[model samples]
Target chain A: MLQTEQEFIRILRSRLEGTLPEEELNDIVSDYAEHFRIGKADGRSEEELFCSLGSPDDVAREIRATHLVKKAEDVKSCKNIFHAMLATLGLGLFNLVFVLIPFILLVVLLLVVFLFGIVFAIAGPAAFIYSVLQILGIPAFAIWQSPVAGVFFSIGITTFGLLLVIGDYYLARFFYRIGIRYLKWNISVITGTEDEA
Target chain B: MNIQFKKGVLEICVLSVLARKDCYGYELVGEISKRIDISEGTIYPLLHRLKDVGYVTTYLQESAGGPSRKYYRLTEAGRKEEHEQKEEWMRFAASVNALLEGKNDAAD
Candidate 1:
């Protein structure tokens, strides 16, 4: 294949076209175009300039990762963070262990806590209903203790469940904040195009 | 040099160059590639990242024979970052040099 400025810019544009905003994409493309223009003016051949610039695809991937990570930081959401993580994973295979594993672990942990909270919350209401029925002498189910005692236990379970749910929300928010910082650090340090050197 | 070592130093290299004087993308790439054997394409993305973080800003300057060029200048935060990184790199390099010389003497 011919190593010309057009091909370099084409590859970069094709990869980054949709990922980056239109103006930002144009700005980045202009930088490379200018680089080629100046290099040629300095008496360097197109092929020499292209070869020194390295793979345009790698450069595009790094740019995309940086942009996605920044977007995630600016707007915190599941979709944004997921997109950011996927982009970062494309940087290298090392992220499978470093980024992917930890990400999955955190998601699983959050899910477990959320599910447990819901189960307890529902169970507390059912228990409360059963205790009320027992108090009315309906004899729906055998009581472990007095119906009054049962009411207290049920309330305790409800409160504990509510606390778990609230705590899980705060925990998710905390991780999201820390995760954004980590992603930014990863992009700036671990995932740069220079890493491919 | 190890790839990881080179990757870690690229930021400092870019910052130090801009700390000296603002440079257009091509000129900056030439300056760095003259010393470090790395892809020239990487520097542009690095510059963008620096700009996004407000460490560097760009301005258009007219050239003698061609269209205006976009030159990257370091921000105040960028200057502080450069100074801190330079100091850290110097101390680390000094210690490593000392350790290597000590090992050479012991080997002799």
Candidate 2:
């Protein structure tokens, strides 16, 4: 309810406390403190300055999103990018369609590919073992028409599976890179204070 | 102007301002808000982002009747970015203007 500098700083500190590093958080707070100080000295009331600055909550959210995205870029990891995506999603409802849906779809797609690769990889070795057993006079293991051909087929399947797994990895990496760029652009162009005229 | 459109250009505007001369946080916000209606708080975060990317750097400068203020100066990389963005914006604006004018003539 208060539009004082202290209230603005309080909201920012509370919102950003755990997300930003201590030094960086202090630096940001000082920027605002200085802003209020200078504006007041210019004979403007604290409420006028505060209203012009918009909501501190939005400011904190933007800063947190930007920081997380930059961190993801600096340290390449699934967890980092996931956190970055989550942060960006908080920017606006636009992200629910633009960011959240694509993110979920990508994750599901990648998971399905990985699971298929693993199943094929495991099945190839099992089939190879069964074919060898059938050749060694085990009647029940006779699934393939030709044992020699089965061996070749099993090896081919294994190679294909392995390739799929490796391809999925590179695909994930590529999307991770593109996703970071998109999130950066989204933050820069999409989010703004509600006080837009 | 669209809010999203305004936000998209905020970076270029800030870079262009810093390209001209170093400014303290309040001074820079004043310069931009005078021309564009925006949440003045957002500029600080933009400044921080610029600093993070090494596009700008800051130093403390004492004022006549106040404590030291942090002044932001554009880095070499920041200057290059400003020039590129300015050129891109110019071309984009020119084409849009041409299209609008052509449409106006056809309407008449």
Best by lDDT: 2
Task: Return the top candidate by DockQ.
Answer: 2
Where is the poorest 10-residue window by lDDT in model 1 chain B?
A: B99-108
lDDT of 1 by residue, B71-101 (tens): 9999999999999999999998977887877
The parts of candidate 1 lying over 4 Å away from their true place are: A191-197, B98-108
lDDT of 2 by residue, A59-110 (tens): 9999999999999999999889999999999988779999999999999999
lDDT of each: 0.89, 0.92
Error in Å for residue A123 of model 1: 1.2
* DockQ of every candidate structure: 0.58, 0.74
lDDT score at residue B7, model 2, on the 0-100 scale: 90
lDDT of 2 at B61: 96
**Candidate 2 CAPRI category:** medium
Residue B65 displacement (Å), model 1: 1.3
Best by TM-score: 2
Q: TM-score (chain A) of candidate 1?
A: 0.94
lDDT of 2 at B2: 80
Q: Mind listing the fnat for each candidate?
A: 0.76, 0.84
Off by over 4 Å in 2: A192-195, B103-108
